[model samples]
Target chain A: MHELGIVFYIIRDVKAAAAENSVQRISAVVMNIGEVSTVVPEYLTDCWRWAADKEPLLKGSELKINMIPAVTQCQDCGQEYETVKYGKTCPHCGSGNTFLLKGNEVEIKEIEVPNN
Target chain B: MDKVRVIEIKKSVFAENEQDANALRQELKDRGVYLLNLMSAPGSGKTTTLIKTINLLKDKLRIAVMEADIDSDVDAVKIKEATGIQSIQLHTGGMCHLDAEMTRQGLDGLDLDGVDLVILENVGNLVCPAEFDTGAARNAMILSVPEGHDKPLKYPLMFSVCDVVVINKMDVAPYFDFDLEKCKEYIAMRNPNAKVIPICAKTGEGVEAFAQWLLEQVQTLKH
Candidate 1:
């Protein structure tokens, strides 16, 4: 739902970064998407297809999403493990005493572009 | 002809939004207005809370509102009619969440010289609003009892980012099997520091407590 808005921001940032570095055309935008984030990767790509076409540098650029599994660290037992899905309690100590360690990221880690 | 390992620059994806939100936060603080960005699902009684809050604290504080919606000014109109307060309704067209730029525009339209508290009623969506920081001093989220107790688990980011949590629609607790304890536990588990207050906006139960807490938060920001 809000993936489109986020996609716009991603494109905006990547373009700005690319322009700053004198990159002419973006080939791909790499993202680290947390499993727990509400953004759907497919929907994001769909939005990318539409929004990127308007910009010359990103006309054919592809959005590459790297899915990160949701992992949590138990505060009580000091154990760390991947959650079953998005909100499964820690399996090691059965403690709701867990904090999210990763898998909430929605960041563009890198960008690939043509250097001219 | 393929030679060098070009440029390697690592930058944040949300740099622009982050920058804009930071500016907005500073602006609000400079104007001596405590801003609270409110978020919740649709039909969560956010408007009712605002109405009740205005009634309770209008005499003691100079309060204004910026209401964000997708298509309607109905909520803003309601707030104005009920409280006689100055409120500007921002229609984001089709956007689900309000961004820093939008919030800045709204703030520009406001008279903040004497405003003590400014409340931004975010679009009725839990997930997106949490991601966009509108430079507010605090992020407050509402969860209605009818929406169920599993909300904190399903929407962890919203709960985790909240400085205050309002469990609205408590009057319906007798009819619905809403687990109040579970809701509190879930919110506490997600965010230990968030202040959770239960309210029934329809019956005006706990509205006074909510207003008092909000007033204290604003007072703290003044110092």
Candidate 2:
């Protein structure tokens, strides 16, 4: 699946950051997965476990996912509402002139390293 | 006695990919090539619609296509045989989707000297392709009648992010239980601004209108 490709990216970035900071062992990688993001958290972690374990620095490292709620903004009413609940229409104004404000991200929020 | 210290680094996982996508967008904008990322489920007439689109616009504008798949050059061959346009096949090596970096590499392989339009036929999958922005100026998705009308409801994110939604295989709309109006309503609910065009690539119906819309977009980019 594409999750493996994403896991590789995470590994590459984490390795680069670790080398720069002179950190030897990575303890966990935190991800900010939005509610609407296509990447399934379960599949991502499953792929991460398989790929991350192969790297010495990431062997036994944990993958933590932080779910972000999707929100939409109404251009007409200037109101913010849950994207999953209301979709493109703003519930308050009943206007179809709306756009997503957040919750489509698939980003690394933090990378944790063991300090000894 | 030893103490464990924790170092926290906040960064986006897609930062590198998004940066590459933005750079590629700027590069394409400078070159005046309007790249369109086309996505849909497998066997949804994506290639058929693309070929039809090429036939409509090949004479009006310089056009090329990059057919991406998990493997094989089947779709690429079809494009060349149908329109005689330059078609390149990108084997994703088992990946179901094309990211910005992959799209950049595919474009680099092509000779865009006089070409004003380049369409990236992304791998036939609804989920992953929608997640990654391939630096296309616009994103279009095709949904065949046989695929059913509830797809917009099932895959809300895909419908939500697209600029245009093409309902292909309209010629056979009578036989199937596909509701044209209902489908449009679903798409509108998810994406208010998305343009929905009902087309039958087999019969060339509604292809001209779609081509006109595409030309307008290309013209906008040119100016």
Instruction: Tell me the TM-score of each prediction against the true structure.
Output: 0.91, 0.88
User: Cα deviation in Å at residue B207, candidate 2?
Assistant: 1.1
What tens-digit string does per-residue lDDT give for candidate 2 at B39-149?
A: 999999998898988988999999999999999899999999999999999999888889899999999899999999999999998888887889999999999999999
Per-residue C-alpha lDDT of model 1 across residues B33-56, encoded as one tens digit per residue: 999999999999999999998999
In Å, residue B129's CA in model 1 sits off its true spot by 0.7
Off by over 4 Å in 1: A75-79, A85-88, B1-9
Q: Which candidate leads the pack in TM-score?
A: 1
Clashing residue pairs in candidate 2 (N, C-alpha, C atoms within 3 angstroms): A107-B13, A108-B13, A115-B5
Question: Global lDDT of each model?
Answer: 0.86, 0.90
- Please give the C-alpha DockQ score of model 2: 0.53
Model 1 misses residue B49 by how many Å?
1.5
* Model 1 lDDT per residue over A18-69, tens place: 7788777888888888887667999999999999889898898888888989
Give the range of the ten consecutive residues with the poorest summed lDDT in model 2 chain A.
Answer: A107-116
